[model samples]
Target: MELAKRIQPTMTRQEQEQRDRKAASNRQLTALLGKIAIYVVTTTLAIIFIAPWAWMVSASFQPIGDIFDWPPSWIPENFTLNNYTRFFEEANIGRLVLNSTLVAGSVVIAQLFLNSLAAYTFAKRRFPGRNLLFVIMLGALMIPGQVNLIPAYLILQHVPLAGGNDILGNGGHGWLDSYAGLIVPSLSSIYGIFLLRQYMKSIPDDLIDAAKIDGAGHFRIYWQIVLPLCGPALAAMSIFTFTYHWNDFFWPLILITSESLRTLQLGLALFVVRNRTVWDIVMAGSVIATLPILVIFLLFQRYFIRGISLTGMRG
Candidate 1:
């Protein structure tokens, strides 16, 4: 009886401890499972986002025949540079690239300078009707570019005094189908000005006052002090401006008629001119056109990220 009682008590205590340990293990297991689920969900989302780009890269290398084969392949079985070669040789794609680069570069430079200046004035300077002017500028953002396309085209076509036209909006060659037509309308971007203005407002007033006290003129303060500190915002605006101009199709399609003056985006459209389209060549041209932007982003990725983050901070 003594042996039985002693053994039973010890067994009961051991069983209880074992049960507690198992409960603790179960709690740990639950936490681990939650973390694993979160990780899986995150990875799945990343794959979804990356899959399209991966497909594009794969498609660019794929042979024409294999592109539409049963059960789409992720990897190109027979990779060839023939598409790229054909694009460059047949389409004069190099010239198209040059045109895009020139237009995008000019837009970026002009927009950055003008927008930054306007933004600085709105943010720091005291002037009559400043608030009212800013409100008006903000309101311009609501005006769709499509709504003004017809009027803008007409104005360009009838621009007086410069294109050898009289003030009556007639008898001039008109800027239509020219580089000037392509660029002039986009010179002053209201959104760029607004973005820069918001960013500039975050700067402390004391810095401007101190700079002014040090005999810095308005232009000097803007050029020397303000511009340097606005690297993030400027970088962001540059990327946006560059990308927009580079990829712009509708405006160039409407304005530029000459094959030689065609931008990269417009040049790519020429592939579909025939009743039957060459998917391989078309995709190849697309790949080429997209590469430059990708390269640019990769090269300036740090600035792009900084710009985005900086802009978000103010918002």
Candidate 2:
């Protein structure tokens, strides 16, 4: 009887151990399956997102015939750099690139300065009719750029002070087809001002107070204190402005009639005129045009994220 009692207790302990091991195994299996499912879903989404860019890169290297082949070859049997070569050599792509760089660069600089200055005033300064002025500026954001296009063009055409327009606004040398015409009008972006103002408002009042106590003027406080803290917002605005101006097609197409003055987007459109579309060349040019943006994003991606985070905090 004693032996049987001891044996029963040992058997029970073994059984309990077995049960615990089984439970642990089941839990591990369940966790592994969940991880695998998550990985599969994430990989699928990544592939879907990357597929178009992959196809673009592949098509850019494909031979002229393979580009429009019936089956749509994803992998080219004969890859060549002829498209790129032709782009640089025959198409005067360098000049188009220069035009894009100059226009985008100038717009970025001008918008940054103007928008930041305006935002500082809106955020920090106590001026007469300030709220009314800000409301008017905000209202401008609601007006579509297209609606103002004609009026803006007319204004540029009759710019009174510069461009040789007399006070009477007659027979003046209009800024049509000029870089200044393309740039100056775009400089006053209400969205940029609003974004910067939102960011500026989030900054602690103590910092500005300290600067003021130190005998700093509005300009010093702005340039030294506010602007440094606004790096992320400024970067975000810079990216937005640069990309918008760089990819601007309609406005440039309307304002710039001279081929030499044509931006890259406009110049690329000239490649496909009246039903003659060279798909390979067009895609190649698109790839080229896309490179700058890609480079910019990669370089400023950290700043961009920081900007977004700061903007969200303000909101």
Highest-TM-score candidate: 1
lDDT of 1 by residue, 1-315 (tens): 345446567567667677668878999999999999999999999999999877767877778788788888888999988877876788898799999999889888889899999999998999999999889978877888889989988999898765676887688768877788888877868778877888888899999999999999999999999989998889889998899899999999998888888999998886667514577677788888899889889999997787777656754
Residues 1-315 of candidate 2 have per-residue lDDT tens digits of 345446567567667667668878999999999999999999999999998888888888887889888888888789898878877765689889999989989999998999999999999999899999999977777887779888988988887655677876657657878898888888768878888998899899999999999999999999999999998889999998898899989988888888888899888887656326666776788899899999998999987777667556644
All candidates: TM-score:
0.88, 0.86
How far is each candidate from the true structure, as Cα RMSD in Å? 5.2, 5.0
Give the Cα lDDT of each candidate: 0.84, 0.85
What is the overall TM-score of model 2 with all chains considered together? 0.86
Q: Tell me the lDDT of model 2 at 291.
A: 93
